[model samples]
Target: MTGRPPKRQRIEPRFHDGESGSLDMRLTAEDRPAAGQRPNAPRKAKPANRQNASSGSRSGPARRKSAKSRRGKGGRKRRGGNSRLLRFVKRGAYWSAVLGIWGIVVVAGVLGYYAAHLPPTSEWAVPKRPPNIRIVSASGHLIANRGDTGGEAVRLEQLPHYLPEAVMAIEDRRFRSHFGIDPIGLARAVFVNASSGRLVQGGSTLTQQLAKNLFLEPDRTFSRKMQEVVLSLWLEQKFSKDEILEMYLNRVYLGAGAYGVDAAARRYFGKSARLVTLNEAAILAGLLKAPSRYAPTNNPKLSEERAQTVLLAMHDAGYIDDDQVKVALAETATIVANRQTSSENYVADWVMELLPGYVGSIDTDVIVDTTIDLDLQHAAERSLRTALASEGGKLAVSQGAVVTLDGSGAVKALIGGANYARSQYNRAIHARRQPGSAFKPFVYLAAVEQGLTPETIRVDEPVRIGNWAPQNYTRKYRGPVTLTEALSLSLNTVAARLAQEVGPARVIDTAQRLGISSPLQKNASIALGTSEVTPLEIAAAFVPFSNGGYGVVPHVIRSIRTMKGKLLYSRKGDGPGRVIDPYSLGAMNRMMAETLSTGTGRAAELEGRPAAGKTGTSQDFRDGWFIGYTGQLTTAVWIGNDDNSPTKRATGGSLPARIWKDVMVAGHDGLPVSALPGIYEAPVQVAEPAGSGLVPPGRIGDDPGRPILPEPGKGRGPLNLLQRIFGG
Candidate 1:
């Protein structure tokens, strides 16, 4: 085929110009010349002329110059314009990389510096929590968790899944996947904050929050943040994700005097965390941002609103469904009432006071088994609060206290004040005030011991001794009344005359035998409760009359045990053995019982049970006290001002007796109604002799400022030293 084509060799030509010559073009590899031969090639010879040569040699440079000129007019302008933009982009990239590197370096430097300041990793340890005093009532119900933490550490699995889930959803959603820190979250936070021009969210994870709460100081500085990061990494390395979450849940502060979720749950809802509902979990989880502000006890509306936000977040995190969110949103969290919440706190504090004696120094956690009856405690608190609320302003009673004790001297219930949160000073045990007429029992007991029967007649008329002349509270004295009537009427003059007859020493001895732990004055006025005494002392002193004249020592904590179930202390025996004389006890009980049945403390009479008590109004009504008892319990109530200001004639029969009656009624609910332990004497209403007109003795002294005895006693008054030795 090639030889045949070669024979024809037909040519195709093309013309460039109108006048022109033809030019041959190679169309394929077959038209190219052979390698060794010059065949099939055409060349033009050079012309020999200086001007033409110069023009020909200059053509390339001239064309290039012409193209450069054209480029300067258009292409160069385009290229230069693009060059600035490229240079800008390149410079931006360079500086961005440089700044990024510097930023990393600075952050690394900060982290290193803060980490250097931290304690050695080998020495790092979770410090032991402060000693927690777990106080429980007589029925073994948790009265109050007292200490810095206010609760015990709970395990991770012990809490409900919704609890930690709520925490993670609202606090740190990526808690599972993130390695201590989440850069994506941080970047998003920065972006959102920058775009909104406000910090809407924090970049810290739950681990970081836990780290700050557990290990680091709460300071919002770069150093603090860096330390938090380092601690968070340490925590991640030391513990699992669940362990971290558990620590956080157990240690995080939840306000309302609650240090952990357990305490908070109990404080707000009166339930354990395991029993907390989803709504409660959300509310508790919402407290992490601001515990006080979101506390349900503080503001339920705000707490519920924050909880709604938390529920929405949980739904968005896919932890809860729409129905659940809706249900949670609709649910309302009811905080525990303040009175009920802190009722046990007073008992807990009372128990704590006795904890040191039982367990010595509280180096380890101890459980104090207190004698507080929570129900009775609540009753006492409610009674006191209700009494104060209804009559406090009218009576000028700014504060009040109630103490209820069983016959065995066990403090069944105690309320220190109207509100424990407002005042912690336990007036029931610590407040010492004069017990006006309430102290007359000792005087009557002394008189009965000295052979003065309840029918012993005493003239109530005034008698002056040296400088003092005591007047009746009513300013009108009943003439020639029996000892029983004089005491029932709380006649000051009769009480003074009896004190003088028995001698103040015997009266002091009688009070000490019964359980007055306070100092009693040896002066004649001692018969009128001129000495300061605590409500607890008064209540305890009345116990002997209820318990057939057996003395009692008031004790709250019954036993104490360590967290490991080792018994630290236990009360072995009963109170000081039989301090009161049986005869005197019977006579005193009979006389004092008459006071409640038909006297100043008549308002304290129970509907079904016979009661015995005394009404005491301190000088100028500074304090109103009702120390009363039934067969089962003896309670004392004090109503007064913390500032020692006089009340609006508040007598023991008004507020104090009412409170005592309420408490005793509630305390004796199930117990059988029994008569008070004593001898009962029938009322002896004597007919006044028509011709016997009782006249008061003449005033002897220029100044009648001192109180006097109506008749002389057989022996001298008991020494104050001996009274002190035998009494309290």
Candidate 2:
């Protein structure tokens, strides 16, 4: 083509109407632009005819359609993008609604599950509080309270204003404002507990606490919490604010077996709720958090600290001014020493044991009038504690018990242990231990009933029975001694010999008849006090020796009645009947009397009055006992180790005799000196003034009707001696 090629000519096409009435145009090569060159503009041409113009309009429609297609394509892209976003938003909304419904269902299901375990709303009601047992001494002084509700319910108005105020201030500040639930407090507690990873605070209101104590078991669980919330709401709706507070104060448990604020006040302060002071009220309020932990009797210093916290709370709540808080802080509550650790609780415990038998199923508040003389109880406890404090460590003795009874078998004083707080085991009424030679009285009484006189001779020598040989305490033999002398010296062999002479069965019968209810083994060892017996029974058994041989059943509760004065049980005046004959009673008294006068029990001898008793030392000095009595009272003292370990040679004549003498001295204070029953002999000398009505010492007899000794061969001794001395 480059070798001298001919040049190409340009051609322009013109529009024309074809036979089909369509417009058309044509262009020659001349209209096309050369490579890399701009094309020349086409010149406008006029329509050839009207038909041609109309045909030209068809081309305009084709161009417009092409432009419309381009615009539609862009709009389609925009529409597609918008539709995708709309679809995404719609899908999200649908799923959100589904999840919301499921969440509501789950919460409702959880709530329903917990609600199903609760009782029906119609059946829900506040449970009745358990009845209380109030025990008072013979003088009508409250000794203790025994029951689920330790004391009777106290009205809100009956208590001091500060008492309830302090409780609300520390326990629930918004108790009167909230509807049983403090959402603010609960949220704060939750946040704190979660942040600290431990539970250090509680969000329960006073009504909630009452609900838990009244109806719910002490369990920690989500279910229990839910139930508590439900019950709290119910309680709030049913009871007034004052009523709820009163019920909470009365139903909440305090320490030391106290149930209500009244009981706690009486238990720790020895006063009623109405008499509690501001300091005392603060202390009581403090115990609501942890009763045992902050009990004044348990930890006084810690309790005071807790009370200080309560006082501050009270001040902040505007219940008390700064001066009042200062006064409260300065004047700490004085906890009554006796109420917390008194020996009266021992008597109260005994009364409680006998309560159910007197009135079965205690369903109401009852008052028990017990025979415990507060004075004598104080004396007994004082003497026992004094003795133990002085000689407990020296003698290696750790515990002791005492029991005292009047001629009519009324328990005047009873000390179960050295410290009742340390041990509640009532040794006086429950513990059974060998009485050693104390049992010899039963053996001698049996002998006397079989015609053996106090002057009767019995050789004190080593004796054996069925491979068992009994030796005297002194391990020496007295060739011949009277029955009185043998018993006064507490000769073990002689007692064994007598048991053999008069069958052991007879001795047991005599013991049982005299109020020794414990079982006795039918063997020779029984005569030497090998059998175990409680101090109560032993003291009761000796009552006849001082009261004309009339048997007695040891009783502490004299009468029981409801709080409204409805009598439930009243002790009758009838005696336990005669258990020993005149001759036997006289003979036994004569022998036992010599023990206090010049024998092992000499330490227990009274100064201005005649006393009779026996001394007993168990094997290896494991137990030391002195059971003695005067014309006024009979008391038993036992000192030993709780572990049954031997002492440092402590004998009945030492600690036991001294404690018995001290107790007797206090018991017989201000009373006229009198002779023992069946003993018409006067005292050696009149220790008091002549106008004191004291029988002069060395007098032959006071009563002119004293019986005279009968002939040696008489059928039985004269009954006049006993009849005159005992007023039989």
Candidate 3:
């Protein structure tokens, strides 16, 4: 067969370009050459394909499928990531909800635990404040306040506007808006403390502080804090903002034993809260943070600085404008000088001790009219403090006490110590120390009551009783001295001999009769003033000598009355009358007068006035004393170490006498000077020739000068004879 196959015939369908599109002129499969054969030759059968093929092998659809597969993979990958993220978020939310629920439960349980310890809601109420004791001086000037609340509670309306404003400004500016607890303040405090790495700010609102002060213990534990919070909420719910502020002002404890704004105002400024100025109010408010640290009486400069801070806070809080702040800064609060350490409080304390005895239990505020003269009290305090401050170190004397009284036994001024703030031991009224030679008056009085005169003679030589021998302070004996001279010079030997002969029991009786309540030892040493007694008692005992033999009980509270003016107590009369007879009184007064005029107490002599006092120095100079009195006033001054250590030769003739003189001078200012009772000119003694065997008309001398006579049962010897003559 020929290789060439059939010839191809071309047929074209003619159509105009405009009429119809050109038809296809290519060869059709039916008219074309057969496959697997030469061109135009006959067709052959197809062999079986080895390669596997399916619908997936189609290129057109496979390309499309591959692209679709790639797109699907990317979509699946994105969906898987989204699914993981969604699961993570769901788990986190679920755990967060669980934790949140547990946290709320724990907080609720903690709050419940603290709240359970509290009183029943219906029973919650402000506790009644302790009754106040307002002590006023004899001249009706406020001396001090004595009570749980140092001063009376003042109403909010009574206080100056700036006082509460200053407190609110510095303590809690959001006081009006906040609901008991201040979350914003707490958060701010936390942030500040955390950032500073220390506690510089407190989150306590005013309500919180009041709550803590009123109901909660002053502890810094978390439990206490929670309790404070609960109480604060309760307080806010129970009272209005103004009421809470008022309670805070009236209950918050300031320093120096003062509680409440009224007390603080009076304590620091010596004025009522109603009268406090802006600067003073700021100072009072400044004390809230640390009362002692910023107390005006303690550190005035620091207190002023703190007050300045308060002023600034007030200015910032819009309570005071810039002009007002400037004015306040310029007019820094003038703190009452020495208010905390004032000797007036000593008198107030003494009155308080006697309050219950007079008025029974103190359930209501009482006004105690004290015999204290504020001016004289200040004078005494200044004198004692000045002496101690200037010479205490040099003399090795740390403390001193002074007590002044009128002849009627009214305590005009009393200082218990050099600084009452440093020590509250009322040395004037409580401390029983050896009066030393100050007790000699009682001995002499006893001898006088037994018919001895001031002119009676006694030898100032060493005397012994048992094993105890009393020696003079100078350790020198002055022989053949009169009773007046012996008492004036405070000769220990003469006193000892007299007490031995007449019996110390007589001396005890004399002392007790003259208002000395302290127990006395019945011994010869007691004549040398070895017995212990309070300054108050010693001064009281000496009152009879100044007031013409009328005994006095040293009293500070002149009268006591409630705030409503109901009289509870009033000192009725002068005293237990005539404890000392005229004979003994005249003799003792003359002898003690010679002491101030010519003896050791000459330093305490009051000019142009007849004053009598005795000088006393305890053994080793541990205590120095000057107990003296004018016709109008009697004062006792004692200087010593509280620990009973010896001083640096501090004698009664020195610091104690100086303090006594200063106090007496101040006490007698503007008063008529009069001679002491029973003080008169001594008749001039005609000089007796030396070695004369005859005794002078009124003199009882040693042997040969006087006859050696004895009483019945007593031996007829010089010693017994002399004892009879001198001891009587």
Candidate 4:
């Protein structure tokens, strides 16, 4: 028995038969009849045995309960899983919101703290740059740019388009598109710094960099960074975009102590901003990154590599074409090796030192028109450095100086030392060293004024005064030597004798009158240059001999004027009048000329050009000097040590003479050769002192084949100065 096959019936919504002819009805799934069964058909089933029926009914109830239990368990498992997923999502969202709010609060606090330290933006104004001195050579060559800026401020429009473009490409690619601070760059920097765990990159926009340079200190703190941001925003609001860029290019530090693009160009490439080429522009643009580290002047090879990177960046930025990039990469850029310590600065310093005296005080930018021949100045520096490099080690010479002056006493060139950077002590004008035999000319001039001819024979034997006995450099003496010969050979005893006869006072007077401004000791030892004097002093003193007995003040700056050409100080023809008399001038020139021709200064001779000079070696070679003069130029060169140590048997005739020759040859390149003033030869018979004491007065030796002295015994009447000094 199928247990009545579970009674199946069909139920449909029924309407009353009298209501309508058609019945509206719908059959539902629960009301539908079972498969293969008619409505109410289940009532026909009958049970056979009571036990089997009971068993079948019991089994059906059990299976239904088990299925219900399984359904309940599956439903509870699904509900639990849904609850866990919902809790996880809700917790994650809660924490994410809390962290985001916390991050906002922290950023706001930091920004506020830095903002409090910044000054009010309303009170901001661009500070004025320090005044700069533009120094130019006598021939209008820019010798150097002086003062803090190191060069004149150049306008943005004055620069090459590629120059600013190059800087923008490398320093800030989105400079124009962004506001004062570049959000994109800052975000990128944040990401990079976060990954690196350090502040390795500063994503400063061009406007931000200008703000820092103009108004903020270079501290790498967040406070400084915030201040820079504030200032950059202010700058953007206060000025136009191009104006901001102008100020930026004019204020950026481009290494080598150069404050701006113009200064960097002048300081490094030795040019103006407008003249910067593609390669040079690339190199200068590269300097914005760790300026000194990548400075072309300091590290050329490394700078080239950096420049290549800049060129690639510029090309990538579309500021330059591929061909331009190739050209810049292939070409080389020249840079000034040292701008601060350059020899040109030495000259500029010297000129500046005198500026205060000439114009009282420099409170504004001024143009100094100097007499410095930049070419000759370079030659002087080269000669000094070359000499030091080649021989300074062996000769124990640590320093040297060179000063060249024109016939009118204008300083042509002046080098203070071997390396201006190593030592700024201007040895040329500040070092007071004994001139040794270079001083003999003054003593000889005194003797000649007192009427002793250059041809007068003097004993070269050892001479003593008090406890001092001056000996020859060779420690050997010729029995009889003419006064001319003695001065030529730098004979110490003869110089001492001449100094004694003329009296030390007369020698000092003569020297002071000529141009020796240094104090001279009034002792007999003055004959051998015991008095300390500067190379400039000695060089100026020799000017009288070259310029026909006229004194010189040794001026450097010819005129100082404003940039608009307003004269501040113009040097007039001012100097001490003629110091040496005509007769003595002729005699002195003859003797000194002999020294250059065949004596100690023979090494300093100019080819076919009449030259006269003196060689000076202080006692034990403490100083070596060669002060020589052409018809046009007079130069003095000194080589020694700062401590006054003796040289390695180095004499004035060795290094100083060679340097003088090298300098003068270049100095007289285009000048016509001329004869030395008052140089002449005279024929005379000297009555031997041992045979008859009668002598020819006013007759010096034959030098340059001229008669340099007046007629004998015809000394302006009866027993003039010459007749009295030497018996006629």
Pick by lDDT: which candidate is best? 2
TM-score of 2: 0.74
TM-scores vs. true structure, each candidate: 0.77, 0.74, 0.71, 0.77
Name the regions of candidate 4 deviating beyond 4 angstroms: 1-123, 297-302, 339-342, 360-365, 388-394, 479-481, 680-728
TM-score of 3: 0.71
Instruction: Give each model's whole-structure lDDT.
Output: 0.79, 0.82, 0.81, 0.81
Q: Whose TM-score is greatest here?
A: 1
- Cα-lDDT of candidate 4: 0.81
Task: Write the residue-wise lDDT of candidate 1 on 1-728 in tens digits.
Answer: 44544466554556323322233222322343545658757533334432354545433334347546644577657778999999999999999999999999998888889999998899988766567787888888888787887776677888888899999998899999998998999999999999999989899998898888878788788888989999888899998998888878878888867887887888788777788999999999999889999888777889888999999999999999989888888877777775344766777777777776666787767788888888888888889999899999988889998998988899998888888777888888899999998898888876765545565678989877558798888899778987778888799999988888768887887788778878887899887788999989889988888886678889897889888899988887888766554444555666777788888888888887878889998889999989988778899999999999999999988899889898988898888978876454222222222432211112111112211111123212333212221222
Give the Å error, residue 98, model 2.
20
Clashing pairs in 2: 10-30, 683-697, 684-697, 685-697
Give the distance in Å from residue 665's predicted Cα in candidate 4 to where it truly belongs: 1.9
Worst 10 residues of 4 by lDDT: 698-707
Which scores better on lDDT, 1 or 2?
2
Instruction: Compose the digit string of candidate 3's lDDT tens values, residues 342-431.
Output: 677778778878887888998878898888888988899899999999999999999888988898898888889888778888999888
Ranking by TM-score: 1, 4, 2, 3
Clashing residue pairs, candidate 1?
467-705, 467-706, 468-705, 468-706, 468-707, 469-706
Q: Tens-digit lDDT track for model 4 on 442-475? A: 9998777665677677898977888999899899
Tell me the lDDT of model 2 at 115: 69
